[model samples]
Target: MGIQHVGEIAVWASARDGNADAFAELFDLHRDRVFRHALRLVRSQHDAEDITAAAFLELWRRRDAVRVVEDSVIAWLLVTTNNVARNVSRSRSRHQALIDRLPRGMYQGEGAFDAVDAHIDAEHRETTMRGALAQLSIADQNVITLCVVEELGAAEAAAALGIPIGTVKSRLSRAKARLARLAGDARAAVSTTGGAL
Candidate 1:
């Protein structure tokens, strides 16, 4: 629909044909989005970088299997990122358990921890949303991620997911409602606990 997407499609085709420059172009175009999505899932900058790299590696490794939805590879990349993040999270669980046991400084550096009320509120909302999204069924999470997080069109999301457009739209709607309910319940529970995490 946009010129960038047209360029992206051409670049992807070239990359699939073993063009190094085109592959780099694809990586440059998508790295930030993939990284941001990873950051949301993992909540760690370094882990997000690893997840983003792994997703792109999978893209090249599985190029023939990658699907282009709505003249773009973003849906495939993002879904792959999600899967990669999950796997990484699972594998890192033991390592993270040890890491958590290690002592860390308490907001020692300036700007390390923002004490602003607005910042805290935004952080809380983000945390609650991440928690709620994690609680959703995989199907619901897929629809929500494709349709809402990545802003894929219903038709595009349907194609990416191999479902009808109507199904994608309906599932997105229901998933959004469920997510909102979960967030509300979380808020209520936190408030009842005197805002304790």
Candidate 2:
């Protein structure tokens, strides 16, 4: 059998025998996608790696509850990764600290004035943006993160966040408003600088 067949069989067998090799094969099959998904949510490479490891470990822990259809390991990984990512978010003090560290200037797009400066400025702005995003309510943030950042769209975001489509829409609206207010303040600051110039 190909890797696809191997994955399904391994998951099925691992579910019964607690076979570490079977679990390892499953991890090999899905780790990259899972890591990328976690990275998108966690926004730190190190955290993403940890989340990926933890997710696979958790999958192995609950192997019996896992069901598989042919080559559908990615779906299973996505679900597990989502759960692990949320837990990682809840547990990480450094994640909260990053939010607190969002510099006021970065949001205003005011870090530097030259080409190299602009590149550095963009990095800081991203950091600040992620930090600000982390400050929103988890429900609101998850909506925007899944729909906008992850490009998951309305229905997919709802599934990932485990809410009704209407709830997803409601939360997304609130998140956008909060994000706009944040961006607006940044723009006003930029304009004030322009006026001074």
Task: Report, for every candidate in turn, its global Cα lDDT versus the true structure.
Answer: 0.82, 0.65
Tens digit of lDDT per residue, candidate 1, span 1-197? 33375678888888898887788888888899999998887756888999999999999999988999877898998988878877786787887677667677532543443444335445777878877887787778888889899888898888898889989888898999999999899988888976633
Candidate 1: segments with Cα more than 4 A from true spot: 1-6, 92-122
Report the number of the highest-lDDT candidate: 1
Model 2 RMSD, rounded to 1 decimal: 7.6
Q: What is the lDDT of residue 69 in candidate 2?
A: 33
| Candidate of highest TM-score | 1
Candidate 2 colliding pairs: none
Q: Give candidate 2 regions above 4 Å deviation.
A: 2-22, 40-44, 62-122, 183-197
